[model samples]
Target: MIKLIATFCLLALFDFTNADIQADRLYELLKTKKSRNSPVSNTWSVSDEATNEYSPVYIASQDGLSELDKIVTLPGQPSGVDFNQYSGYVTVNPNAGRALFYYFVESPTDSSTKPLVLWLNGGPGCSSMIGAMAELGPFRINSDGKSLFKNDYAWSNVANMLFLESPAGVGFSYSNTTSDYDRSGDKNTADDAYIFILNWLERFPQYKTRDFYITGESYAGHYVPQLAYTILLNNKKTNQTVVNLKGIAIGNAWIDDETSQEGMYDYWWTHAVNSDATHAAILKYCDFANETSSEMCYKVTDKAWDEMGDIDIYNLYAPICLNTGLKNASGTGSINVFDPCWQYILETYLNDTVVQKALHVKPTSWDLCSGDTDARVPITASRYSINTLNLPIETAWRPWYLNKEVGGYLEAYKGLLLITVRGAGHTVPSYQPQRALTLFSSFLGGVLPPPS
Candidate 1:
């Protein structure tokens, strides 16, 4: 029986069929590789100085568009834009502990010292690669959810852009031990993300001192800040302060649940997305809490719809993939459940295959809308009910996600820049990557820009 298991494991480890051989390593079982893990896999012990020093980061300019374009090997159509793509893996806990799928697109400019940023999406289970292919990445998959297209305003132009598919269970990133996959939470996810960076440093070694920034949205407001705080704490303790850790930026973040839900419903009324009758009723009777509803309230879908009354603009709650047919009929197959937004990514993305090749990922098509994906996951109920008004930002964690500890799941971190793009809903990048780009650059530079 042991022999049978050993042989099966070896086959899984050796079956490397992919564009980049590096990616195959992620699937390789530690048992078969039998090799030691990345060097910086050690845990943090209370120490004054870091036990290790990362290699110096070599800065590059945002020039050489031609070179970067080639690196991605994206196709071009006169009507379509040219973009780049690459996919692989990074080891977070090298003791064969944790791993994350890595994706990047060389900036359009030839500059070697371009800035580096890691972008993540929320859902705790959603993959950021959707950012690479659907929203910020140079390419967008066709509506078929299988083909590829070009994205003209890819973020790589401004920085050495990268996206990750993390926490196992989501995307091609898998775990050797199901134990890791079985459990999911903020702390573990952040720790694993930190380890992934350490391993990423081991692999690239060159970008150690590079100005590194972390960014995300929605539930990621939590994922992004928490991860940044971990890096900040670890850097101070381990002496591996090489992470430029410049600044964290989040767009339309779910900062505080009370405010988020309030803003959500108010947003519906202010924008004429919700019925006046529903809005007034919510304001008068619904506590957003004891709303006299049987089902759980707050962000949970079913009850939220029954309570909010088509706040999504003649739409119920976030729609399931069932309405994908609507996208096709309306020529809207550009986005998917994988991404919350980016349907517009299709308008210009499909024309250029160069962006597709640069991303090194081939999907039958891309799902830009998060609404569709929400249908599949196990629906959740918020700890507190959604707020009835757009409240103020009080703490780090949203009321729904907060647990009495860690400040009700709200963490307070210094040096984070918050951005809210007007006229944008849900995922900002998919809806407004350009606006997101402006906010991102300002955050990295440690400055706030005037809102549009």
Candidate 2:
């Protein structure tokens, strides 16, 4: 039954019977292929100076409450925009000299009435700025990779969006304490994020009592819920209206390793991304249920990766960016077009020194994806529940309706709701913006995704 469902999801992937032995060679090449930014050197320089002269900041009001750290205006901001945007940093831990950067966009209208939504992108180390500029924010990277265009369906249309680059080392957020990056974990991350929010509220007192929500994708499956739990815990401990965290929504989230691993291998197999022999080998040698693998399993997995070819595995059916000469080339894909080359464009635009200076970011290479993937296993291994806080394999799956049709599946264990976006990859809004917005709107309304 699971195979059938995966087959339906991946009918367009590949045909296993047509696979050839050359796949082994492809797999071998993958093993040694280094990233363009391989051997990333530590960019942190020794500073005997106590103050960072490069840090750009703004404080609009008195009492030290209303301030925008590193406030910046984007280089190519679109013309005649009604919404207000502030990009800067907020120091969460002064002793550690740890500060997290953020991009906040007020709703297009009714800034005071709309809820505040915090968007996080997970690498356990990736920047949330990607989520803001590339995925669901009000502005998108232009084809030239140096300009911007407005995203019509930006989440800011419905809510005040807050995009954060967290945990001391992701993007512009940094710590004077070097070990903070090495010591970063889900618990510390959640604790810091909670503290950051409290400090952020002190800066923007208007939203002190407004409705708030947490939303993110990928490893944020751990980041979002854990932070939400912290907010809940603190709320109860204080018996006050501090956070106003109402709900959480995650897209294409990694809930559990065992289930995700099973789903991934299943996805690859049914999509014909791997040959039947390779699939069988995986089943025999790899234990997805226990998160264990044998030597033979590793070999088979390599073959599978080899067969995956030069396509974006995240969106299997999506096109690959084979052209490296993209500087002058208006990429074949754009925000609405869902072009696969968006990543390249984003990397180019964010790393620009001018853009960096505008955002008050020190000169350092910005990586789209970073951090140790291992930090996440500890997070998923523990049980988390909306009610009891235990992570369970079998959730209460129900069909959520949107536009009177089945939009996706929704499962609620106690008060926690997990909604799976239909036909979406790791990033739901990027692949299915309309559906994602529907889910977002419904989730904020305290209802299921549209039941069409």
Candidate 3:
């Protein structure tokens, strides 16, 4: 979804947030007759999901991302579409008082029995547009982040890919209630996604029976499993239409904050990013070093949490990644725009036209930094973004995203094989395509080319 974060997003501070402006300029998005009520506000339209035409789904290869797919649009949608032959919808979120942009990827030539993959971006409010065109989708964009690029390793090659701008307040989707944005809890996000899928299937009835999978990264670690659980719960009730779901997967997932941070510190020491002396110092003073001042038995997780909390091993999100051989000199360099983790490889991937064309979003400014609310807030001056907290909060994706098993090797999870890049900070697809492909092959079925 964020594949377009850097490429686009010049003016996010638009009146899109103002209820008065929307009521005066466009259709009154805020209505009195609705259930998921929050304070009333007018909603925007689907066209607002993205600032431009570049969207999700991409095709990537050794030649990088290529751009040559049929331009298919959906019916029952608004006008001015590139292709009116396909199926799409403009989902107005009644709760948040806004509209979001969303679309589906039907089989290129056939609509036979197929699997569905929903690719989402993190940031809680980020757009999954790039997820459609760039990451694991069918095509990529040009250098301008506006045109199209075809991806050879697109996930659509194996299963149907669906992208969404969720939570009513994010992207081009809208809800009338401002309170909708305020209550963006795990349960709400999961429920909204479930509803979107149900409505989406209704819009494109052919995909109703497709075996579906939930896949994403970052905070989506929380999303995939949470949503899957909701589906599982719904499957238990009668008269409820069950969403045919397989398994769940996430990459570079911020599953359990406690373990992730501990893993990061260990990773830094082992990778030589920090000196043994400083590494020991962090461990000694560990931010979360103690439990009940030494004589209390907390939840077993607190032990791990305390250790990671004590050490600022994250270096303020600046772990150096040199395995790819791209170096960041002193001062701003390469992907060092914000954090220095995985700087080398991320910079290299952004330069590939194949990647660009495959994703279909041509970023005006390419950087290694996570949009991470960087454009809106002063992250440079602040210590950390909500992302840092979003990562550590204990959630459901924990057991699997850790890539290990405690009670058993795991459940009968037939979801996609998901893996997090060892050194990547954010967006593993952008930082570590090779590992992403390897895991993709392991979980799914394919021969992903090693990154060039």
- TM-score, structure 1 vs. true: 0.59
Q: Write the per-residue lDDT of candidate 3 for residues 51-125, one digit (tens) a residue.
A: 333222111121210112223321112233321122223343443434444546655544366667777765445
Per-prediction TM-score, please?
0.59, 0.77, 0.53
Top lDDT model: 2
Expressed as tens digits, the lDDT of each residue in 66-105 for candidate 1 is 2332342434322434434456545454454455667766
By lDDT rank, best first, the candidates go 2, 1, 3
- Number of the top TM-score candidate: 2
User: Any runs in candidate 3 off by more than 4 Å, and if so which?
Assistant: 1-100, 287-426, 431-442, 445-452
lDDT of 2 at 233: 60
Give lDDT tens digits, candidate 2, residues 104-221.
9999899999999999986557788878887798878766787787777789988999999977898888899998887776677887888788778767888889888888865676
Query: Model 3, poorest ten-residue lDDT window?
Result: 1-10
lDDT for each candidate structure: 0.46, 0.63, 0.41
**Model 3, C-alpha of 320: deviation from truth (Å):** 12
Deviation of model 1 at 179, angstroms:
2.6
